[model samples]
Target: MTAPRTPILAGNWKMNHGPSQAARFFADFLPLVQPADDRSVVFFPPAVSFAAAREAVQGRPDVRLGVQNVHWEEGGAFTGELSVAMAADAGAELVLVGHSERRHVFGETVDETVRKVGAVLRGGLVPVLCVGETIEERRADRAEAVVVEQLRPVLASISAEQLPTLVIAYEPVWAIGTGVTATPADAAAMHAAVRRTLAEVYGAQAAEGVPVLYGGSVKPDNAAELMSQPGVDGVLVGGASLDPAGFAAIVAAAG
Candidate 1:
């Protein structure tokens, strides 16, 4: 049988690259992503680059385009916000929601994130819903509780059958760009916790099929061990994604 979950290596190009840069970056990077392999590789540039990314990977079957964020409403009067339809129209197969940055920087409430997840799924786009605990939360030994809380709100908005169309990313707030990567064992334990929570809410099928990714300062060196974990399916890359070679190396490690 194929692996339990398709390994997904996604890049979150946060606020970087306009269309021109996006096209150039993809041109440089797409060749390394082999769709024939047993993995799904996706990338999200700033909203401005969705068009460019779609064009860049048009004929290449391996590269999938995603949007960094989206509005819950399909469209209408939400200036400065992109709707789920807008992202799909721009050629995105996935729409990232509830990332750490969105929560900490944009003042996005859990309720808002839940609505966005619903919008992404209803619009025929996969939702990459992110959940994580802050440094303080981790220090206080509340990481599991924090993640559980985040998952509850998002799960509340999605239908049981739609679970497969969603990806859950667990990114520790303190590990993001802090050069503090969690040990593989620690990350694995969290992934298991996520799986348990999923099973509790949506049943064993959802728990078994739903892919959970670990995102927090992942590099080529640690990627292999991370993937070897029973519960860690893939990763959500950040700064490393900006460098084509660095990202490719990590993908190779995943294999």
Candidate 2:
């Protein structure tokens, strides 16, 4: 039998929280979350705050640090972009690839996601590849197709052995940061589709080992129900994650 997927409650602290604030947040947040073997917590702080967040989570194996974004190139005049090696050097063990904001707001392409995924793997870091459709795409009944299109190239590019280290977060663009959420059922359906795609690329055993998460306005009040749905492994929290107590509650929900 395949082993149960460990739930991961990741906080994408997008553009929020500086070094001082990150330190303070962890000081209050760490003690509130109890360490467990069944679940893990990851913080995707802005690159500037990586050091503080890393120090804060020091000695706590249950907690991990990740970069919000990284450039595929190792070094260049790419000015203001982070490389996977730099992220790893800064203590980030995971990297967020193709987040909704990165795709819609910043115009990240599927091809870019493919390269970034390769860079992260080469740098020996895990990649949390985010895939989903825009509001219009979803309204047009193309959500699954869009997500699969965004994911296929990257999925096909990686080796089966590397597939298990990959984590996929299906964050519907319509629901992100808009006070809207994909119902537990909606999230489950999309996650199932994502798993199906993973199984297609890598065999059932490899696909089942990948932890697929849901992200979009996930908060403490609704986290438990969302997590209860089949195929929903955990959540990628947004605004709610900025708070110490609130994020702790969501972590508890995952547990």
Note each model's CA RMSD in angstroms: 1.4, 0.8
Error of 1 at 188 (Å): 0.5
List where candidate 2 sits over 4 angstroms from the true fold.
none
Q: In candidate 2, what are the lDDT values of residues 118-200, reduced to their tens digit?
A: 99999999999999899999999999999999989998899988988899999998899899999989999999999999989
Query: Clashing residue pairs in candidate 2, if any?
Result: none
Residue 197 accuracy (lDDT) in model 2:
93
- Report the lDDT of model 2 for residue 152: 91
Query: What lDDT does candidate 2 reach at residue 44?
Result: 95
Query: 14-107, model 1: which lDDT tens digit per residue?
Result: 9888889887887888787665558888898898777778888887777788888898986789789998887887788998899999999999
TM-score leader: 2
Q: What is the lDDT of candidate 1?
A: 0.87
Q: Give per-residue lDDT, candidate 1, residue 172.
A: 96
**Which residue pairs collide, candidate 1?**
none
